[model samples]
Target chain A: MVKKKLIYLDNAATSFPKPEQVYQKMDHCMRNIGANPGRSGHRMAIKADEMVYNTRETIKKLFNISNSENIIFTSNATIALNLGIKGVLQKGDEVISSSIEHNSVFRPLMQLIKKGVRVKFIPCSEDGFLDPDDVEKAVTDKTKLIIVNHASNVTGNITPIKEIGKIAKRSGAIFFIDAAQTAGNISIDVKRDYIDMLACSGHKSLLGPQGTGILYVRPGIELNTIIEGGTGSSSESENQPELLPDKLESGTLNTVGIVGLGAGVDFILKTGLDKIRNRKVFLTIKLLKGLENLNGIKIYGPGDAGKIVPIVSFNINSIDPSEVGYLLDERFGIMTRVGLHCSPLAHKTIGSFPKGTVRVSLGYFNTEGDIDYLINSLKNILKTKA
Target chain B: MDKELKEECILVFQTTHRTLQAENILKKEKIKIKIVLKPRSITTDCGLAIRFNAEDKDVIFKIIKNNNLSLMGVYSRSGEKWIKL
Candidate 1:
């Protein structure tokens, strides 16, 4: 009996198969040293703690962080965003953001808007690009932090982080980056980029297990804790351990995930992140060029080759994103994500909110053949959309 | 044998071990590379290295050479481990 193959184009959500090495590493950790990290003097516990520490150290190197201890572990990008938004933001402070932010970022900050903090969002162009000049004009004295996604999960548009960081620096507002979409895909140096606090999801581009994330807190910027609890160190004190990681990490922490994350960062350092990013850009440009020929397919984001990652968001004319998603799922067996993609404001900026765009996000393993198949599938789907 | 094996620590990597990477193999797999860590000698440049593995030396060097990449260093487990001639 022959079997129908599954074409996975939904890479922006979570990576697939996990490069074999990732799976093996996670399994080895779960099997060998499944001990509570930072708890005991035992060898297993020590090893586990070392694994988490080493992971933080690796992340420090990956993003060119000034200090290893400054990197903190969180549940995911959402949690990190909440922590950054909630911790540093006092009521009545102002924030400046781009329209192209995941709701994970927008919602938290938006929640504080009603509580006295003024929030201003810089609009993206129809093609999903944010302008630095527009950001410059939007800045006000009350603006405490300028939060924006490094790259859009929906449209793959990369904001001019450096230019905006400069604006924030001049205005005395801290720059917080949602590196959820760009962390492993693009090159980001906290020092060079002038980002004060950057949130990253380990599972997406870094190929780590779910529940693993990183928050790079630049030195001299202290974010108060949203959750306070035991940090293996400073047991005598009732206060959350005042140290960097302990202050950020409130509980037992995801040790196995962090161990895997260490390996993930090590992998990126070995492979050279620029090399990985170029391959995705190559495939994405190819996809864009093909979509240009097909009728009824509307592409979003700036058409510039180097402006984004492998993620693409588009839709067929008059076709609901749910219908498109179902057809790709049930008929074509090509797994693609559709709808608002948890970033309704971004969709609204691109004018695809209520019924959103079908997004195909590529990764390191995605090849030209995969792009071709996706293009062909969309073409076929378009022709049959009676 | 035990001491030598302990000295030669495996530098676990995410990508293929053959690929040129940031981590290094410490010289003298059994002993930590003390010279690299002289007091006040670290210039914010100290990085991780496994106790050196001799066999991995040539391949790693060749990768850097072929890729036109420069690395920090390479070595093998040493309590009298042979150096490349």
Candidate 2:
């Protein structure tokens, strides 16, 4: 029996083959500095505490955040979004979002609707492009929060976040962004963008291990605590401490995962985010170009690669998306995602709802050869259908 | 014993995050400081504090103030007793 090499194309879900440093640092943290940070006075515990703070400082630099303490770590982006949304909004508050939000933002906002909160989902174009004007038009004085997904996980459509951020600032609404798909793939400056809150998945574009995510809360945003417990501070007080991170972060953090995240961000900083993003863009362009001439194949989203992230969604005529995904995996050893991509609203906007499209999400580690092979494999699949 | 430890003061913080942050900022300035357990008598938010020479008190306070750290207070060790400064 022969083993086949697997080609991973599901980076939008979670990045694979993280930077070598990520693995090395995680190993070093577990083996050497395996103490709960900030909980003990031992040397290892102090070292662990320093490592966690260093990661915070590194992330602060990556996002152009003013204060390192504003960045809070969570299990994943979903948790971060939950904290930001539930923490800030009150009854009768109007929150606006886009049609192309991942369930992370959409579901949370929807749940708020039942709590007497008004939730308006601004519709996007067929190509999943969100017009900033629509967002501005939806803004009301009652609008307390404007949350938008930085990029679509399904179509890879990049929203006009800076313009929307400006509108939120003018309206005095908190501008929150779900950077689940854009964080490390695209550069973001929380200050310049006028973003009051930003949530991102460390496992996705940040190239960290799973169970790591970040939420950046601007200074002066008095968010209510969603969950509270022991924070290793003010031990005598029965109430949670009113510190920046300790106020929100209430438990033993994922120290090992965070250490790996630090190394991953360091890799991005040293290699340069633009360089990493450009490489994926180059490969994505090649993949899109290859799919253009294929018969009976319908490509979705911004057909132009430059207009979106390194993700492509398409479908073969007369075939179910899951079947296509299965064939690609079982037959060609390629891994791709199909079906709604956990974003039914985005699927509806792109007219691929119910039976979604096969999605190929490229990563920095993916090569041109990999794209060519995918194209050839897709071609083969199409030929058999005919 | 080092002359610096002969007369020492502990800088306390509201959270361990600030304590570690101040340690980094002070260490970069080549200021002598040691992270000692929060004095058993001092009930502060954090379990740790920076023990430095009483002579470095002014400089340490300046650094903490410049960084906008949430410092609880400074305490000096007078013999076996820790007195709040």
Candidate 3:
């Protein structure tokens, strides 16, 4: 008898069945170093501080940020994006971004537009890669920030950050990247590419716990803190004392989440981002190779295989993206995420913004066998209709 | 062919990057120093600890600190271990 179980392919959303070490390490930290970090002078507090430091250090190595203090924690990528976008942006300053950004970048920039900040969107092709020349043309004297998504969640295409970063530098605009999709799966070098701010999700790619991510701000650039509360370092002052890490970080820290994030980074670092990315690319190539022959199924993004990440977005003809998602989950016992993916512009650029597409994002733990099973399931579904 | 040859010196910083930044800054100052990883005896941070003759340690540390830069443990090698000043 064949055992029927679920196969989760929505890693672009959140990873499930985290490594045993992630849960175990977080459990041990909670039991032992359960004190408030950066709050007290006690050993537990110090241990908590040390734990966060070690984790942030590991992340610095992961992202290749020369200074570990530059990695500031946020509740998530959305909050980090909001903090990075809204804090530095001022009235009348123009910000240029792409048409494929997630709501995390779009919503904040849109809010800035409402507040008198000018917003411009550079168009991306239907396949999802942006035209860097369009970005070059968009820059003007008023432009202060250039925000872009590292990879499209809708199409799994990568942006030419190095090329666009040069454009921003030429225009004297601060370049901010929403690295939610690429954080753990790809290697990011902040200095080599001249990146100003990088908003990351600890949970998604880094395999860290949710409610914990980082916003990497280059030193010497100051932004107003969005939320203010106790920062343990400078309690004696009434005003929020501006300092590295603590200046941008406010309120009670997510100590346990941060600790788990550290362990997760350790895992990512050991596995190596290049190896992880290659594995996902191999799986995506395998699935795409199998899928191309199937009738009634349409695929998106570059076919070179290397151009795409582990993510794959597709739809079956005569079926709604949501219904395709539903059938895959209910009838197939395979968990998948469907719909606009919160990027209307991405959909608009790809001509599926309103209707959306079914997204399958692979992660480090997934195997070729998993891809084979998914391919079989999809073949079975579309075969009946064919 | 006669560029001013300022003596190369080692500079320590509070932040992990300062020691290297010091070397770069010193290059502009026409002074040079070989920056190396800070010894674990100073701090567990991945910060750099450089080596040069003893003459430049005080001035380098003073310049690095005066700039409000990060410095962990700064010292010169007395054979093997980094002896902190």
The whole-model lDDT of each prediction reads 0.75, 0.90, 0.78
Candidate 1 CA-lDDT value: 0.75
lDDT of 3 at B28: 58
Model 1's i-RMS, to one decimal, reads 12.7
Top TM-score hit? 2
True lDDT of residue B23, candidate 2: 90
| Residue range A157-183, candidate 1, lDDT tens digits | 898899999999999999999999889
lDDT of 2: 0.90
Better candidate number, 1 or 3, judged by lDDT: 3
Task: Enumerate the candidates' DockQ scores in order.
Answer: 0.03, 0.71, 0.04
Name the lDDT value of residue A237 in candidate 3.
61
Error of 3 at A263 (Å): 1.1
What's the lDDT for residue B60 in model 1?
A: 46
- Write candidate 3's Cα lDDT for A1-386 as tens digits: 35567888989887766777789889999999998766553557656666777787788898788777788999899999998888899898888998899998888888878889988988888899988899999898778999999999888898888889999989999999998988887778887777999998889988888888899999888988888876654455677757668777877789899988888888888887788888888888887887686778778776546887678888888688888788778777888889899988898888875888888888778878877877888877777656
True contacts kept of each: 0.00, 0.80, 0.00
Q: TM-score for model 1?
A: 0.82
What CA root-mean-square deviation does each model show from the true structure? 9.9, 1.4, 8.9
**lDDT tens per residue, model 2, B1-85:** 3466768888888788888888999999889989988987888444789889888888878888787887888999878888999
Interface RMSD of each: 12.7, 1.8, 10.0
How high is the lDDT of residue A189 in model 1?
A: 85
